[model samples]
Target chain A: MKKITIDPITRLEGHGKIEIFLNEAGNCEKAYLQIPELRGFEQFSIGRAAEEMPRITTMICGVCPTAHHMAATKALDDLFKVEPTSAAKKIRELMYSAFQAEDHLLHFFFLGGPDFIVGPQAPARERNILGVIAKVGIDTGSKVIEVRKRLRNVLRIIGGKPVMPSAGLPGGVSKGINEEEKQTIIEAGEYAVEFCQFALEFFDDIVLKNKDYVELITGDTYQHRTYYMGLVDKNNKVNFYDGLIRVVDPNGKEFAKFKGQDYLDHIEERVEPWTYVKFSYLKQLGWKGFVDGEQSGVFRVAPLARLNAADGMATPLAQQAYEKMYSVLGGKPVHSTLAYHWARLVEALYASERLLELARDPEITSKDIINLPTETPREGVGVVEAPRGTLIHHYKTDDEGILTDVNLIVATQNNSAAINMSIERAAKSLIKDGEVPNGILNMIEMAFRAYDPCHACATHSLPGRMALDVNVYDTKRKLIKRLQKNSCTTSTSGDGVGEAVSNT
Target chain B: MKTIILGIGNPILSDDGVGIKIAQQIKERNPDLKVVETGGVGINLLDHVIGYDRLIIIDSIKTGDGTIGDIYKLDLDDLDASMDLTPSHGMNIATTLRLGHGLGYDTPAQIRIYAIEILDNTTFRESCTKEIERQIPTIAGKIMREEQLCAIHTLGSPLCQPLQNRPVSKPKPRRAR
Candidate 1:
């Protein structure tokens, strides 16, 4: 048996390495998923003012700043025991949906779409959207650019800027939208809805045209069922902001539902020496490793998880898509992680429909957008369903509202174990005879990208000096190949181009 | 004609956010200036710099033995062939600028870099050190003056501010990475 290693996957966020160890017996010996550095954001946030957390924590990850901002705000609200007004909630939801649309678009088109469209071996220079424009039509490229701009415009109108919006606050948003701003949101929403629909059709066409890649879709089913968790309203509709925490099993069995403040009871985190990141699992079932487990405590979050946990989406189109997803994936408990992209696209459609509904709601245009908090508590926990997964922020404050402690569980952290599992499975199935099939490694990386893991914000480490190692072995447990790569291309300070190589 | 001033740094890592803070101040003073805060010089940097005619880059540099807040302005043409000036995430800013230049897409002709000398880069606190924070306004002022000079130079007008009167500081020593 031979071993193969690939260190520091390139064009991705954060610092992580995948190691596959096979023994002389031709069997898999060990699979190590290592994130070599620890970012103690929570520990360092102990003395800061809780009110500043929304902005402060937004620095955690550039890719998902909106999610961190929302979660931090929610967490502060919980600590203060303040509930935002209905209008405030709607505006916040709208802003988050816009962020989701933009983020998903970037991930799909710019980040992951290149591998699927241009083929994995394409040179890095030609592997981007520009390359897509060269190969496909200029129309597709322009459409992508147009969609991103519209989405960014929506975010700017709501959050005051596109990347990290300062609109979110403890009790409610810092400001409210005026008539003109509301109109802008409505127009953007209308355009976004139409644009998203067109993009979905385009993605579907891509999938249909490439029948060999259909397995990646899981036939419109919920792929990785495990246990689902998210925030859902009293009407059992999915919500990005302000809802109770709900968890369900693979068979769509409701196991537990708790208020956001009670999340500590259900979730527990485990640390491994191999990686700086920790694996969080359901506390009741105990730590059941990544691979085989009774679907009892294996929890999944983000778009797919949120969809599975909710009874139905607020919009008819989303409801229809959700039902179709359930029907296609054999009615829940999707074990295959690759199906997340489908769920993300479905949620994107749902978000667009929801945005349209909110825009048209007569109450949305009302000037009463913010409901301020009159008092403050010593602690709060804010939970929201980010585009990628469930995001939770817990903060403890002094009597004067100074932050004393901050705990954040981002979307990617919720899916950490599953991400490791998917990588291992993909490695085992794809790496053969010490040779990685073309696109196989890329497919495995794509599997991780499906989760859209934000390692930079999720983990605590500097940008450079990161390493990743992958090892593969044959059935006889003999080492076939070992691949080790660093993320930095030129400087050892880890401040260079992030490049990863798959060695045969 | 639209200007995007990208401030690149790791906020949690002390002075890395100097560029971003400077950009923010400029945006506040001049609403017309589009200010963006980025983590590093990567592919995202390339994306942000595209379409902007004037690029102002701010970052923290540990240039050997230079006093903190020493400002430096280097033309893109002066960059060495082997300089690893790219960011840690995507492509480097230098490469991106070069790429845009090669593509015949009229790259930013006026590029300015204001690098703050960092004493510490490991802290996770929000506020920077007293020395760096104090220099923010000074850096902002200097950048504004430079922009005026650039504008005047392009117009071929007589110097409003005497460039010779300002003390020419020594270039900071380059540290081995």
Candidate 2:
């Protein structure tokens, strides 16, 4: 009897390991998705000035600093018991929209696009952005780069920096966009909307049109019936910056809707001994393990969840695209994980439209920003829809305005339980009699990638690149097979990067 | 010739900030060089490094076998074959360079990557390990000498910017992470 361990995985945000345990009869017994936790963020945050949170938290993950910055800013506003002026809120939302547009565009094209555009069965080498360019043409590649540059420029204009935005403050943004900056943002927004529309069309022509790919999207292996969560405006429209946190049942009925401060009342984190990442579940429903369905407490977030938790998109063009997605998918609450890509594009369109609307607002240029806090600092909660999903930042400050305690239930953590469940379900349905099928790794990865889960945010790492490794074991728990990709075993004495090892 | 010096790392991540620290020093010493700092994202790195005739990238890397503060200066040919040229799912620095070349991005023909082996990167700290910190001036000095040699060879060329000697300023806070 032996236990096989695949310690590090590749092609993800952090180290994720998949362990498949076989039964005595050589059939798949169970599977576990384990994530390594980076330690001490909470401890490190203590004693820091509350004002430094936006800057410090953004340093956690280079990928989604904007989300943390926004969440922290909103939390500061709540903590100080101050309300930003109208212009401030609009400007915050404007920067947020740009962030979403840029992030979603990258995820769709560079991160998630290769899977569909290049075909899932394509070799590891070909299943990437270059492969996408080869299929879509080099002109399309240039356009992708061009559009991204413009979007980031808008971010730079608003946030004062691109990668890590510093515009957000306790009651408002640190800076306001003038006419020229507003004009640039508007142009970028228009281009983003057009590009996203084109992206949706491209998905339809390439992925939806192909019967095999469509089957893959609707296939049972990729489907999971789970509760969905997101942030919605008063009218139940998808809102990225500020909104009430909403939860919908598997059947698309509103289960609970509450303000940002009331999250703890609705959600609870479930800890497992095997991993550092905590699984969040509906507090009222209680912890029901990893099982899905109406009774299960495990819930999902990000694009599909957002689409399900809300009534419709706030913008007209996005609303149309949203309706089309639902009609094609056979109605609300799409459980198919593959559909996340489509939903992401739809949201991209919505974000772009929102960016334009905010940019065009007459008061957007007003100097009335930042309402100084007069109340004593205590505890406050702030939530925003990160490009991935609903992100909640809760903080408690001392009387002197120093951070005393901090708790973050990031969007990915909300989907942590469901992500594991999805992976196990895919593994069980696809792996037969201990036989690993072609594209099995991709199948498992597809489950997690849909979430675009940032483990780097949840748990930190060095080199900050995620490595994924999958290990299979026999009934006796003996090591059987290993598959690795984008791994970092390279000798860093600068000879070169590491070679990926794929072995069975 | 037009040249760019880039530093890549999470500045708050202890030893990982070594690259940025060195880049800052180099910027101080050579006011004429186009130096910038960034988190290690391939596409973003590509944006900054493109269109340059030469690029010198300073980064902190973890080589299990290397000692703390050891520096490795490497060229493109020195890298391994598995480092794909196209942008893959998680494109690293090597992949970004390859992608730049593949896309006909006018990528720097003369490029060097100085990887400083680090002992600690997991912790959240503003400073680096003392050992790595000690090497900052030496690394910056080395890079400056290399740039000077290149400038001397390329002097009088229309593409080359004028070289100037000036007193170094105190390091200022970086706007980027």
Candidate 3:
């Protein structure tokens, strides 16, 4: 049997490689996603002051710095044994909600939207944001840019920056919204809610209305029956910022709920020699490889997982949207991975509504934001629902507030095992008897794309965009075909396989 | 004419920070150039580049076509050849510009890219490779000459003035991450 490697998985914010082994009959036997690890992150943080973590740790991820910043700050609070004032909490949540809205909107329209909006089988060139604008009209594109801009502005006003926020402190945030800033944020949040509502309607009209797309969403290839995890408030409502970690089984039954500090007791990491990314599974259920079911410990996070783990949305409109989604999708604990898109929109609406609510609060403008910590520093854990999934930051510091040890469980790692399962399942099911159709690549990509994985930090960079090279081999482990982005061609001389086929 | 000198890269990632370092040098020499450092990619870069009459971008390139510290002066068309919509960081510049124009945004009329060939973008560090870091001022000077801005050497322009002190070595890299 020959091994196929798709080096540098394309269209995601990270560098991942998918290797599929083909049996003698040419059908797929096994597939694995290999993710390279960024070197020396733990060594990089050693000896750094504990207070600098919020700033330093946020740089770990380019896409979700706000999530890192929040988690690090909350960890700092726990480390110092201090609580933020009510005003500080509101201000922090305000910025966080805006970030959530911006991130979700980006993923849905720019990253993942083309798959559904422009049609799954659409040509490579037409399956992007430009194609999306072409189908939805230029006005909708402009509206997207406007809403995203407004949401970013809201983050800037509160966090004092556009991309990476620096407002988080041990006890609270460094800045608070003034009356004028409050009014501006209020308007922006209100607009965000409206924009998300419009987005939901658009999805309903275009995606749900199409029978083929619905069938694809509910298809067996994309379905995974496993545990789902997220953060929930006191009412067991979906919460992005501060809450206890909640896990639900495949049947939508509560598995366990625990504070952030108790993560090690409920979850465990398994390692493989082929990849640097550790596979995370439930501690109690034990590791069961890549299989998904109640028997298997494989679980997922991000939008769909968050929704399934929670009872309902916190806001009125988002609650309605949530109810509508479950009803249409055939009930709770929707196992379809493609439902992540719908769940993302519902989350965006919730984030927007929460932003507006926080913006309108009277205490949002209070000057007493930070409650300076007076206790000795030790170790603590902080958890937040990153737009991608649940993000956990744990740090150990000396009494001098100097960092001694640090460990971070990023959102993507939580779903890594499941992502591999999704990819393998899709690949096995889609590629039959050795003949791969034209759109096979996109179909395989659709499985992991739903997770919105971030691997840029994990892989090397090309000149501009990373080009994915898919190499197929024969039973003798000799190269058979080479399919690459932009120019897919048969191997001419090197690693000679067979005659050429140029699809792109 | 309204112009923007954009430096794009991940500052936390080793040699990738070269673009931003050069952009900062340019800003220090001539504050009137409207320099902006961004880690954003694809459409996010569009937001910063639009509404300007002319744009000059400094970024690190890994084309394997040149040696480390080798500089290439490219235009918008060159980027068109390098367009791969399936991107991890952000969209390629050409796609971003096209999207900006298609959406009826005010994209810059003239665009020039100064890309420095470099290695080691995967490491977590606050500084660029020493070889590339040494070329910051040179790259800054190249942009100034191309843009026809008042040179630091010969200038009584509004923003150009003789530096009271110039550090011989590369400036200590700040923790932008």
Candidate 4:
């Protein structure tokens, strides 16, 4: 028997499953993205000391630990009803900006970049960071590594470590930066800013210069018009560390802007039977069942959504990049899903610029970093624009600060509904009349990869890659084909495809 | 040799935290060894692993057909080094190592991987399952002995002495044998 295998499915075992139910005509009826979720986080949090949140939450993910740490620390600040000193906020924001820059750079060059940089139709072997290096030259790749190393050194200097930072306190950060440490960060920030500029030019030369790639970005197959959400400063500029939660309608008009604590008033989660991951949507609009556009409650969060929801970037260079993006894409609130990667680059520029700005601030080296909380602990919500998107940390406690309940609306959860929608849309648009092209797997994977959805909870085990399973069901409700991304593929051959796959 | 024992897993997840648990156990018997515990993967690992001579990575694996507490020792060659690490937060061990080498970062000269076959990694808890929890000390001892360090006596054993940072200080509760 010739080894019958699906190409991209075996390559990416990101633990993401796509179940496509086909109609009688062989067209896709429904496509469900079943993501394996780590269970009982709320149960895990209750009874722990509220102050331990910042440290404990960081362990929840292998990636985005910094994001979790920040959100949790902010939640403590809110819970204690204490405001951080100005210096502390700047120090925190500086660290956050560095993290965002490094993370976005990695995602672009490694995860999402391959689809466009190396060309989506490229061979599976060349669709990775190595492929990216092959195209962009070793010099750029070396530069990326250098820049990331410098930024991580800044993280180590301030956060005490790069992966999990213990610098956050209830009222403010645990420590402040001195002049020498500040100097190191300044150098890193300056170098990062330069690299981000190079990155924008690189994007122009690589992605934008390619007509086919641009069309794919703006194309309808990977597009969805949905309400966007993010954190915006008083001037309606994007801020990763802190800001009001802003929601924009599908037409790019501000729908609502409120404090982070008021998130419950706007957002709600809908649970589906097939998957542990809950679909979050606008509470006011109601759960309209995975539909996009204005009336549907389905909203999106993350890089693209942040760009769509915010008015502009905070820094000058990022603002110019932001303007260029909007002008090229035709307007605010770009509904193109693939544009998320483009928005990510724009945000990366802003993050790098913001890091430099914060580093240059004279107040960044102040000694007065933290303030003691006076009020008794109760319920509080802390929200930040994580590298992926809006991350919310909600905590309810008794008078003593023992956590009675904890809720974390991670970046991935916010985009779960939109991710499913994008996947289904791509599947429906690509899988016409039951042909079920093996090529469509990459197309569908590209849809989820746009958001860079990190399901690290259930993926802390070995193999180090997320597995994607594609199950295509016929009209008779029988399992026609099963592809176990990391293992093997068994097509619908009626000759015990299930048995042969099970044996393998 | 400047050996660094890296325990990679979510500490709160049952069985998933076996790596950290074993690292902690190894630390108990050999307090002077340079042991690092991290829930991070890919390039983030380069942050801790730079300048180390040997990297012994202990992680949890759920490969089918393995016993619950079975320990499988693997090297970099055992896994597909060029596997596409599209998702799962960052790059895999192979890619991270290659990237580190490419960038002229003094990554570990030699690497060893101890993948403990696990039963459950999804449930949110700080303790491993009863099956795997029992063999953690034995497993830790085996890994240390494999590294040419006597597990019983390390104070005057004249064995593997490494100098560095130990991030996670929380040790698992050890039972009397």
Q: lDDT tens digits, residues B1-177, model 2?
A: 888988888887787678889888987865767898877465777888878998888776664545566566666654433343121234556556766676678989888777666777767777888888887887676656545633433464322221234234434557996
lDDT tens readout by residue for model 3, A1-504? 011111222232233466777788887777787765676678778789989988877677666788989999999999999999988998999899999999999889987888899887776666678888889999999999999899999878977776677999989998877889889999999899999999999999999999999999998989999999999999999999999999999999999999999999988998898888888899999997889889888889999999999999999999999999999999999999999999999999999999999988889999999999999999988899998899989999888988899998888889999988988888788667887554556776777678888766332233445544455566677666655453332212222111211110
lDDT of 1 at A444: 56
- Give the DockQ (2 decimals) of all models: 0.12, 0.15, 0.20, 0.27
| Interface root-mean-square deviation, each candidate | 12.6, 9.7, 9.5, 6.6
Best by TM-score: 4
Q: Stretches of candidate 3 above 4 Å error? A: A1-15, A457-465, A486-504, B81-84, B87-89, B142-177
Kindly list the per-residue Cα lDDT of model 1 for residues B77-160, writing each as its tens digit: 332222221111233345456645544556677786655555655456566678889988867766755565334444554442
Ranking the candidates on lDDT from highest down gives 4, 3, 2, 1
Clashing pairs in 4: A13-A466, A13-A467, A14-A466, A14-A467, A15-A466, A15-A467, A26-A434
Model 4 chain A — which ten-residue stretch has the worst lDDT? Answer: A495-504
Model 4 residue runs over 4 Å out of place are A1-14, A484-504, B151-177
Please report the TM-score between candidate 3 and the true structure: 0.90
Evaluate all candidate structures by whole-model CA lDDT and list the values in order.
0.64, 0.78, 0.80, 0.82
Please provide, for model 4 over A1-504, each residue's C-alpha lDDT reduced to its tens digit, 9 standing for 90 to 100: 011112233232225778999999999899998876788878988999999999888888877889999999999999999999999999999999999999998888888888888988876556777778889888999998889889888888889988779999988888889999988999999999999889889889999989999988888898888999999999999989998999999999999999999999999988999998877889999988888878999889999899899989989999999999999999887999999888898999999889999999999999999999999999888898988789999999999999999888988889999899888999898888777777777788889889988885434566676757788999998888775542222322221111121110
Error of 1 at B128 (Å): 6.7
RMSD of 1: 8.1
What's the C-alpha lDDT at position A410 in model 2? Answer: 83
